[model samples]
Target: MAKEATLQVRMDADLKEKAEALYRDMGTSFAEAVRIFAKQSVQENGMPFAMTANRKNTYGRLSGYANTKLAAEEDGAYEREMVGKHEKTD
Candidate 1:
């Protein structure tokens, strides 16, 4: 038999409730979902999904505009143009 471990995670109350509800609707609990994610990650030898930084409330009026690219092939020219485009902060 495999030993079990516990992992305590802190997150927004509302977010946690919503996620747990969604998991329940899918016939699982949030903890189970996390465990599945962990197992998949191990099988894949890395993260099973792509992770991106949240852009909201970043630093500019448009929030993360300076870090965005117009296209994957633009070579970062889009980021330069996005900066200072919206001067009003917040």
Candidate 2:
């Protein structure tokens, strides 16, 4: 017999409910989806998906902007605000 490990994650309640519903509609539970992701990542030796930055968010506004530094700072501030807003609280 193989030993099993438990994984714990904290996420927003609404996000968790939405993900669970999505996976259930796909004929699997969210936990199973996570297992599938882990197995695929192991087989691929890394993420099983490609990641790309959103070009509009990353560069579109900066085009011909006089102060790129300020633009980047504003972007960072916005990201931080969003993260704080969505972070789970116990």
Candidate 3:
């Protein structure tokens, strides 16, 4: 028999929710999910998964919200600078 190892991972709420939702859809629990991963890891060099995907120009998506937010932040910074310049120097 092979020695057993324990692994711990920290994930964000949204990610955890996505994973749990996928597992539930597949009729699985979190512990069973971990066991599945361990089996895969032991079989291959690592678990198979897509790490990230480029989502640029995706319609009605979170990326659009992020872009809009960044532009708003830059506009706010410019307004702050203008206000500081117009302040009374007395």
Candidate 4:
């Protein structure tokens, strides 16, 4: 058996309740969810799921603006234009 590492996280009360309810519905515990996430993170180099529940709050007005089709198109165009724009010639 592998040794277990403990992690302490602080989360919003409402979000915690929602996560706990969802986990219970799936017949799993919050700790199980954390373990699964950790396992995935270790296997893959990135997160297995979108954990940014506070995206809208964190992004503020930009969140709503970015969700629109027009904004998405514009964002893609901007990103493509910016990519490889500053390559070093060493």
The lDDT values for all models are: 0.73, 0.77, 0.69, 0.72
Clashing pairs in 4: none
Query: Best lDDT goes to which candidate?
Result: 2
At residue 40, what lDDT does model 4 achieve?
Answer: 97
Residue lDDT tens for model 2, 1-90: 353998998867997999999999999999999999999999999867653344455344435433668666787787788788888551
How far in Å is the alpha carbon of 30 misplaced in model 1?
Answer: 0.4
- Where does model 4 exceed 4 Å of error? 49-90
lDDT of 3: 0.69
Which ranges of candidate 2 are over 4 A from the true structure?
Answer: 1-3, 55-90
lDDT of 4 by residue, 1-90 (tens): 575677887767897899999999999998889888888988887766444546555445335435477665786786666664644322
TM-score, cand. 2: 0.56
Q: TM-score winner between 1 and 3, please give it.
A: 1
Question: Which 10 successive residues of model 2 have the least lDDT summed?
Answer: 57-66
Among these predictions, the greatest TM-score belongs to: 2
C-alpha positional error of residue 27 in candidate 2 after TM-score superposition, expressed in Å: 0.9
In model 3, the number of clashes is: 0
- The alpha-carbon lDDT assigned to residue 32 of candidate 1 equals 86
Of 1 and 2, the candidate ranking higher by lDDT: 2
Model 2 has an lDDT value of 0.77
Tens digit per residue, CA lDDT, model 3, 1-90: 554776676757897888889999999977678887777878887645433335543333444435566677787797788788889553
